[model samples]
Target: MTEFDAATAIGEGGTAELSDGWVIGEAVNGGILMSLATRAAAEALGAAGSHTDPVAFSTTFLAAAQPGPARVESQILRTGRSFSTAEVTISQGETATLRHTATFADLDANSEPVHLQEAPPELPDPESCAPAARGGFAEKIRILDRLDMRIDPATVGWAVGQPANDGEMRAWIRFADGREPDVLSLPFFLDALPPVTFTFGALGWAPTIAFSGHVRSRPAPGWLRMRITTRNVIGGLFEEDAVIWDSRDRVVAQSRQLAGVRMPSAPVSP
Candidate 1:
């Protein structure tokens, strides 16, 4: 099995383990947690082949999920000839980690004409971009080590106390374990980067409260380039948006998230 599959595999009784390799700070990455729940959702819906792709999902991080065994409970909500939906939840013992509602459909069969006003960001090749800045808050996110990540140096000013204050970031990423990104991994990749708020001078723990995303197409093998931009910051809360593009330049996914953040003056969360 691929690293992602193993990290998110569901066992008997809908049991699964959150791997430390995907850890960010003291908890498993929220995206990985969503993956576990989505996998279970797909299973509960008996999704397979072209019909197995989780086309869209909206999840709420109820509590921090530590690395270890967890259980996924999937309740099928609807099943039709074209799509299936499920409500999935992950729990570690008595604590609820997250709840995800997802819809599965056949991406291969969606041949409708594409009309997109959003364009892909023009970024330097992964080989030319700088590797993930290694210091300060960025260094502490362990999941960065599990992926081959390269950031545009221009957006990394926040890493060195000279943030551009633009609330934007662009980067290239792919699994370090050689796992090619597929439809199921799009949501994980959408949340893979550091909070874009870093570019606007807020550089501490930014725990996501809600995340919603859609997988537009299956990704092609190779590095995926992504752009993240903040929508607005209202007091201590902010909303961020992200878009991912495959190696072939196809729009793979898009996401929006709302998280509570520690603006620059506050100490990092423990």
Candidate 2:
């Protein structure tokens, strides 16, 4: 099997480079980019270990990426006792691709627990679903090939897929083409539940304004179910909140992102 360990260092400095195997498509997606940035930031901070979990990240897509050699540069803005902040610029060849910032913090005990407003969508047993893997690139966006998923529709309630990797996970994902997913693609997986709360009309086509995620604990290897909802939609901007649950149905991580309905054709400001 082709090997692409997120823990491995691809490169570092004001600029860095990394490599990933080609999946259904030549380009990378949100999750891979996030992992690259997270790894770069953790390495830069001299963090005790590979980011066991991601706390928060904000990425902007400047251009689409093609599979092959890639590079990432993580800039440490500040390091504090409780928290650290950094920025990452990802690119391929000479063209700049994506830039984003991230914040990491050590978990503390004093953090108060919050009440649960809603439960996650139930999913089918991952084993029941058939594995779908094709050799070449897919015509439409599909992330099923990279994972093991089961979709009984009526019985499962929703899609339940897990990555073949050791510990990392992504959940609540379907294919862009509406066909059963081919692999667990990162972008759509991370974005799936966030916009569910918004009436389809309220979620106008918009670019991501910002994204943030917090690591609660090291997630177990299994199909994690995620529930996403639109928290607020106002002033042409919307915020989506994501809650990820493990196989046992325990919340593991939470993420939030903001986007605006109207975006200029020009680059987004930092």
Whole-model lDDT values for every prediction: 0.85, 0.50
Residue lDDT tens for model 2, 96-147:
7778777766534212263552455655555544333334423323434444
Candidate 1's C-alpha lDDT? 0.85
Off by over 4 Å in 1: 47-50, 135-139, 265-270
TM-scores of the candidates are 0.93, 0.61
Q: How close is candidate 1 to the true structure, as a TM-score?
A: 0.93
